[model samples]
Each structure stands twice: as C-alpha cells, then as structure tokens.
Target: MTQTHIGVDISKDMLDIFDPRCGHRRIANTTAGIRRWLCGIGTDSFLVFEATSRCDKHLVAGAAAAKIPFVRINPLHGWHFAQSLNLPKTDRIDARMLARFGAERYPEPTLPADPARSDLAALSQRRDQLKRMETQEKNRLQDTSLAILQRDLRASLKALAVRITRIDALIRDHLRAHPQLAGQAKLLRSIPGIGPVTAVEMLAHLPQLGTVDRRSIASLGGLAPKARESGKFKGKRVLGPGRRHVRRCLYMAALAALRHPHLFGNAAARMRVAGKPGKVIVIAIARKIITIANAVLRDQTPFATA
Candidate 1:
C-alpha cells in the first residue's frame, strides 16, 4: 500500500505542516492540537519531522498514540535536503522540502521509546546538563581574579556538585526499579571501566545497542570512521555524526578502560606501537568498547577476557 507523506516543521509554540494533498497550514504545538491534526491522517501515513530538541516530543507521542508511522530526522539532514532545491528558507518551505525528502528517500520509521526508557532518558539528559553547568562554573572560577567573584563561583560549583550527586543517586534508584534496565546495566558494568554513568547513558540513549550489528552500533554512536574520496583524490576517514551524549559517555569509558591492562589497555598499547596518535588510539578504543558492549548485550552475557 502507498503511504501518504506529511512534513511537520515544529517550533516552540507552533507546528507548521505541509501535506502533499492538503498543502500548508499551522497549528498549536500542544498535545490537543497535535492529536487533532493526527486524527486527520490515516494509519498508512508517514510523518516526517526534524528533531527540535523537546519541542517534537508531543508530535512523536501523538503519532505513536494514533498508530501513525513517523520518523524524526536530524536538522542538518533536513537543511541539506532543502539546499538541493535552492528554495528560500521558511517554515512552510522546510516542511514541503521534508515531505519531498521523505517521499524520495523512503526512510524507515522509528518506534516510539518505551515509557520507562523515556523517563530514564529525561533524567540522564538532566544530569548531563547539571554537569555541564558545573564545569562552566568551575572554569569561570579559574579565570576570576576578584575575591568576591571567586567566592560566588566556588559556592555555585559546590551547589551544582551536590545537585549532580543527588541526580546520580536518583538515576541509580530509577534503574534499580526497572529490572530489565538493571540487568542491562549490570551486564554493561561487567566490563572494566564501564561505570554506572556510561551504562545508564547507553541504556537510555542507544536503544539499538544489542539489536543491531557491531558496525551499525559503532556508527550509531558516531565512532565509525567514514571514507572521504573524490574522482582522483582520497581524503582521510572521519567520524560522522551520531548521538553526541552516547558518544561522549563512551569516550570517557574508553579513557578509563585504557588505564586497565585487562580491559582495553592492551589494545591501546598495540595501537601505540603501530604509531597511532593518542587521540586516534582513544577513538579506536571507544569504538572497540562499544562493539564489545553490543556483543555482550546481544549475547546476554557478562564481559569475559576469554
């Protein structure tokens, strides 16, 4: 059966829609408005929208509730698709472009995140935000020469640290309440250097960890290097885009893993012997760790050196 493609350009307060049949229109970004709009579409409709931080959450939830197929694409990918047509930038234009892009590309629709996983993801993201704020305050403290500013920064950092610790506790408690997540966390933590933070982040962010192949998992985490080439020229392989939060967590895990010879330290030593740069070796270890984690989860087994 042919599926109808609809593009929705979401903003903080408005949802600009472009349906190939109905043309352009605007609606509120509230749940009611989204549900109302979704009621008009059939189950065979394929809705496409760009990731607008938390703004599109309502749309996704509404689509899932209505049993309509939907796909959330990266904003960069949508922008590049728009560029192909050389059209003026506008909400309506972007929506129409996305509709065309979806029609042509026929991208696979993504399943809605489980309620438990979504809650965990929210907590994980909040923890990251607090940590970033704490780092920023600490950096400011190092640069400030005035005693008054220094005192204020120090107090702010202390408060942030306390809040971060509380959030960490909450994440642990939440994970414990969910047996499946807890089991996965335990499995992930079996590997050296894979701490609670990394394991929780993976469970919350990388849902495809165990289901997909190693290469796909690595690429999803943005660890896989992509080849760059032209007719007569070849460029260096570069890591393309993926989940930033998951990649950051894995990078930290990889760093810790390098300190333990039984973990990834031996692999790092070999890479060093091969004359790879420090950063390159770290990235390689990150890729390896993700692959190992994927395998461990897929096999439902703990990490074993053997």
Candidate 2:
C-alpha cells in the first residue's frame, strides 16, 4: 500500500503545507492548525520539518502527540533540494520541496520524549539560559561604577546563581527518579575528567551508546578526527561536524586530563617523542577520551585510568 507524504515548511509565524494532490496551503503555525492538519494522518505518512535557528519544539511535540513519524531535517536540505531543481526561492516552493523530500527521502525519525526526560531537559536549558544571561550581565559591570548599580548587578548574579542551582537540583532529582538514566550518568562520571554536567550530557545525548557504530558515534558527537589529504600531499587531522555540545564537553574534559601527568601528559609526551606536535597530541588525547567515554557508556563500566 502506498502511503501519502505531507511536507510542512515552518517559519516563526507561518507554516506552508504542500502535497502532490493539493498544491499548497499556507496556514498559521499554531497548535490548532497543526492538530487539524494531523487528523487521520497515518504513521506511514512522512511528516517532515526543518530545524530552524531556534528549536521546533512545537512541531516535535505535535508529532509526538499525533503519533506521526516525523523528522527535522537540516534547513539546508530544503535549500539544496530547491537548488537542484533550479527553482526560485519562496515559502511555497520550499514547502513543495519538503513534501517531495518527505515522500521520497526521509531523515531520521525523531524520538518522542517521555514527560520526565522532557522536564529534565527543559530544566537544564533554563539553567543554561540563566547562566548565559548572568555572564552577559557580569560583563556589563565595567560600564557602571555607581555603587547601587554595582550592588544590584551583584545581587542579580547571586539570584541567577541560586536559580541555576535550583534547576540543577531539579535535573538531579529527575535523574535520580529514573534509575536507568541515573546509572548511565554514573558510569559516565567514572571517567577521569567527566563531571556531573558532562556525564549528564553523555546520558541525555548519547543514550543508544552500543547501537551507534563507532565512527557514527564519533561523528554524531562531533569527535571524529578526519585526515586531510590532497593530490601528492597528506595534510593534517581535523575534527568535523557532529554533536558539537558533547564534543566540546569531551574536549574540555580532555584539556583537564591533559594537565594531569598520568592521564594525558605522559601519553602526549610519548607521541611528541615520536615527532607529533603538541597541538596534534592534544587533539589525539581528546579523541582518546571520547573513545573511552563511548566504551564506558556502552559497557556500563567505570572508566579505567590509563
């Protein structure tokens, strides 16, 4: 049986729908419209949306509620599809391309969130936002020297810190409530430089540890080291796109580990003795830490110090 595919192009305030039979319909990107559109849609009907600069939480939530299989493709996917056809760009055109892409090519199906995990994720994000605001506000201290303003800024920072602490507590409570996730987080923390924050990210982002192939995991977490080569020349090693957040956390962890003699320095020194540059050795250490993190998560084992 053939399944129908519906593609939706979502913007900040508008949603354009395109199907082969029905050319196109522009609708408000609202919950009511979404639910109305989703009525009677089969699981086989591919629902596709592009991830924008900000999260498409509504779309993800709607798909989850509708029990429709959906994917958030990179916005670039839509643009490339447009370019391939040499078509002029418009919301309608993008929507049509998306519908075609959904019907023919589908990206990964988004995993629906459980309420508990959803809350934990939200709490974590709120704390991050608070921290970001706090950092920006703190940087503003240089401008004003009035004791009142300085005192207010200090108080605001303190309050933000408390709120962030509260959010962390919420996350921790939720993680504790969910034994499985908490256990995985614990294993992640067993790694030398992976603190609670890094461990939480590993658990949240890299949940299906053993299932993802090694290279895929590395690439997914933005940790995969790539070699650069040209005709008649081999260039350098570089890291490419993956899960940037996880990769960054691991990179920071690697930096910390690099400071300790036994963890990274000794190994790096050995590599340097064999002619590897310090920067290259540092990157190698980062990769090694990623490998260890993956292994620990996959096996549910404590990290073994090298």
Candidate 3:
C-alpha cells in the first residue's frame, strides 16, 4: 500500500482536509464524520492536525482510536510554512498546505497518557486554577481600600481554600487506586524534598522515565543542558524547556537538597566559594535533582541518601 499523508484544518464549524496524491475535501467537523473519514484510512497512512482550542481534543482522540498515526504540529510552524510557500489565507488552502507539509515533514507523534494519569493531571490543573483564583482575589483586595469587599473577599478565599483541599484529596485518592502508580509515588517520596504532592507530580510529568534510559529521559524531562552559540559568540550551557510540572518540583527539591549536607553540600560550598549567587547554586542543584529523579524512576529504585 502507498504511504498516504492526510492533513486536516480544524475550525469550529468545518474541517478541510488535504491529500498530496488526491485533491482536498471539506467535511463536517462532527464526531460521526471524523470517525468515518479516519476509519477509512489504512494503517500505512498518517494524519496531521494543528492544535487549536478545545475542539482539537476530539479530533486527535478520534483519529487515535481509529488507528491513524496522528501528529499535532505547532500551529505557528504551519502558518510559517504556509507563508513560505505563498499559500493563500483560507481554510481549504490551509488544509492543503497541511497535507503537503505532512507528506514532506511529519511531526513526532505525542504519547497519550492513560486514563488514570489524565484524571490526575486534570485534578492537578484544577488545583493550579484554585491557587490562581486565590491570588487574584488577594490582589484585588490589595488594589482597593474598601472595607466592605474585604470581608467578602476573605470569605471567598476561605471557600477557595476548602475547594483546593478537596482537589488535593481527590488527587491522593486517584494515586492510591493505582498500585503501580502508588509504588512509584512511594519511591519518589523517598528522595529528600520530594513530598507527597511533589512525588505524584513527578510521576505525572515523567511517566516515560520508567521505561527509557536515564540520560534520554532526563533530556526529555527538560533537565539536560543546552549549549548556546552564535557566530563567534558562545555562551555557557543553560536549561530550557521541559515538563514545567516536574521542573517546578525539582526547583523545590533542589532548594532542600542544597542545604541537606549529603546531596549537593560540597558542590554548593565550592560554588559559594567561587562567588556564584546562592540562588543560582540552588538552580544547579535542581538540575542535578532532575537527573537523579530520572535515574530513580528509570531504575525503579529509591534515592540513596548515602
């Protein structure tokens, strides 16, 4: 069978599809239509879609279930590609461009998380939302000197705290229900500064670490150092993108580990002697924590304090 590449331009009301060997087609962006079209494609074919707002959630899930190899490309990449090719501005034109783009360059496929992990992530996101809301409420109070709103705001903050507590409980319950995840959580907690909340967070963000090599997993987790260079201007290594969730937890872990006297105590002392700021040294500690976490997860072993 010929390897066929398909691209779909997603919009609220319609979907435009482009094929390299064949012409394009416009389909209703409904679930039934998406399923039928995806089901018609063979295993040797590939499907590419741009990540849009909420609607994309369905299209990607449908395509995955239909056994189509689906790739979610950064929309900006597609837009730049379109401009480079001098493609016109229209849904159909975008769709065709996507097809041609997919045929020429296929983006890496994303790994979909299990249902349990998905649920846990959702709860974690909700917890973030609550914290944001609490901050906003507090900021509003600070912005005004009105006493009437202050009382009401205090009540609201209390209610938000209660909701946050409930969400935390739900996250714990979900973790407890999965034995494999629960065991991983226990191992993560064994590390200094990795508490219950942070441990579960690492599990959610670094799930692939369990099956992959430590260095590769560390790079993917975004803890690996990136070299910086421009014609004649070379900069030192720096950390860039990785799972923000894991990175945040590592930031905290690094803080605790730096002062623990057993983890990075000597390294921290040398950095201080060299005039590196305490905070910067802590960040270096965080990077090391991420490396160690990758090793712990990949090897399924507890962190050795000694």
Candidate 4:
C-alpha cells in the first residue's frame, strides 16, 4: 500500500504542513489543531518533521494517539538535504523538502515509549538544565567584584542547588515506584564505576539499551568510532554524532572506572601500555562500558566482575 507523505515545520506558535496530496497550509500549534490535522491523514500515512525542541511535543503526542506513522528527522540532516535541492529558506519550502526526503528516503518511523519513561526523561532533562544554570551563576559570581552582586548570585546558586536536590529525590522516587526500572537501575549500578546518576541517565535516555544489538547500541550512544578514508588516503577513526547526554554520562563513568583495577582499570592499563592517547583510551572505555551494560540488560543479569 502506498503511504501519503507529510512534512511538518513546527515553531513555537505555528505548524507549517506540506502534504504531497493537499499542498501547504499553516495552523496554530495547539493540541486541537494537531488533532484536526491528524484526522485528515490515514493510519499508514508517513509524517516527517524536524526535531524542534518542545515545539513538536503536541504533534508527536497527537500522532502517537491517532496511530499515524511519524519520523522525527534531525534538523541538521533536513537542512543539508534542503541545501542539496537548492530550496529557498522558508517554512513551506522546508516542509516540502522534508516530505520529499521522507518519500525518497523512507526512514523508519519512531514508536512511542512508555509514558512513565517519558516522565523520567523529562526529569533528567530538568536536572541537566538546573546544573547548567548553577554553573553559569557560579561563573558570573567568579567574575563579579561587587559584594551585593556576589550575595545575589550565591543566593541563586543555593536555590538552584536545593531545586536540583529535590529533583534528584523525585527521580529516585519515580524509579523506585517502577519495579522494572528500579531493577534495571540496580543492575546498572552493580558495575564497578556506574553510579546512581549514570544509571538513571541510562534508564531515562536509552530505552533501547537491551533491545538493540551491540553495534546499534554503540552507534546510538555515539561511542562507535567511524573510519574516515578516501580511495588511497586513510584518516583516523572518530566518534560520530549521537545522544550527547548519554555519551557525556558514559564518559564520566569511564573516568571513574579507570580508578578500579578489576573492571575498567585493567582495560585502560592495557591501552596505556599500547601507547593510546588519554582521550582515546577514555572513549574506548566508554564504549566498553556501554556494550557491557547493554549485554547485562539484555540478559537480565547484574554486572559480574569475573
């Protein structure tokens, strides 16, 4: 069966839609508008949209509820494709380009995860935001010489710290309430270097940890090194793009793992003996950690030191 291709350009207050069969139209970016748009499409229709922060949440929720197939393309990927077509920079043009790309590329549609996972993901993102805010305020405080400004910045930092603590407690409570997630967290934390923060981040961000193969898991975490080479010239292998939060958490875990002799320390020692650079060794360790974690989750077992 042929599927209808739809492209959507989402903004804060508006949604620009391009349907190959019906042409372009703009609508209010609201739940009602999204439901109205979904009502016009068939169940097999393939809707494509670029990731627009929180702007696409309503559309995604609506589409998921309506049982319509949809794929969220990366904005960077969409922009590069648009440039290849020499398309003018406009909402309508972008939407049309996205529709064409979806039709031609036939990317797999995303399936919605459990609603509880969504809540945990939101809480993880909020924790990251609070940390960033706290860091910025601390930096500003360092630069300011005025006593009054310093006091205000310190107060803001304290408030942010308290909020972060509260969110941390909330995340822990949520995980504890969900038995499966709590068990997974326990398995993850059983590793030598994996802590509560890293375990929660993995649970929240990487829902496919156990379901996917090793290569796919590494690629998703951006730990899989990509080889760069032409016909004759060979270049170094570099890590590709992936979930930044997951990668960051894994990298930190790798650092901590280096302190343990039995788990990651032995691996790092071998790499160091082989003359691998510090950063390179860390990346390798991160990849190893993720691969091991994936296997543990897949087998429904805790980490084993042997």
Query: Evaluated with lDDT, which candidate comes out highest?
Result: 4
Sort all candidates by TM-score, best to worst: 1, 4, 3, 2
Tens-digit lDDT track for model 2 on 1-306?
666677887888878878676678877777877777777456667677787854466667777887888777877767888788898877887887888887777467766766765566566667667878989879977788999999999899899899888888888898989987788788877777778887776666555565566777777777777889889899866787666667767777877778877877788889988998766776677777767777776776888775
Which window of 10 residues has the lowest lDDT sum in candidate 1? 260-269
Query: Higher-TM-score candidate among 2 and 3?
Result: 3
Scored by Cα lDDT, where does model 3 land?
0.79
The candidate that achieves the highest TM-score relative to the unseen native structure:
1
- Kindly list the per-residue Cα lDDT of model 4 for residues 124-186, writing each as its tens digit: 999999999999999999999999999999999999999999999999899988989889999
Candidate 2 stretches greater than 4 Å from native? 1-3, 53-55, 103-106, 142-149, 226-237, 259-263, 274-280
Candidate 2 TM-score over all chains jointly = 0.84
Query: In candidate 1, residue 144 scores what lDDT?
Result: 88
**Candidate 1 clashing pairs?**
none
lDDT of each: 0.91, 0.75, 0.79, 0.92
- Model 4 — which ten-residue stretch has the worst lDDT? 37-46
Please list the residue runs of candidate 3 whose C-alpha ends up more than 4 Å from where it truly belongs after superposition. Answer: 76-89, 213-219, 235-238
Write candidate 3's Cα lDDT for 1-306 as tens digits: 556778888988788888775778888888898888777666787777787866776677786687677777878889999999987889888888888888888566666657787677778778878988999999988887789999899999999999999998998788889888888888877777778878777777666766776666667566777889999999988876667777777778888776688668988998999999876787777767766776787788998877
TM-score of every candidate: 0.95, 0.84, 0.86, 0.94
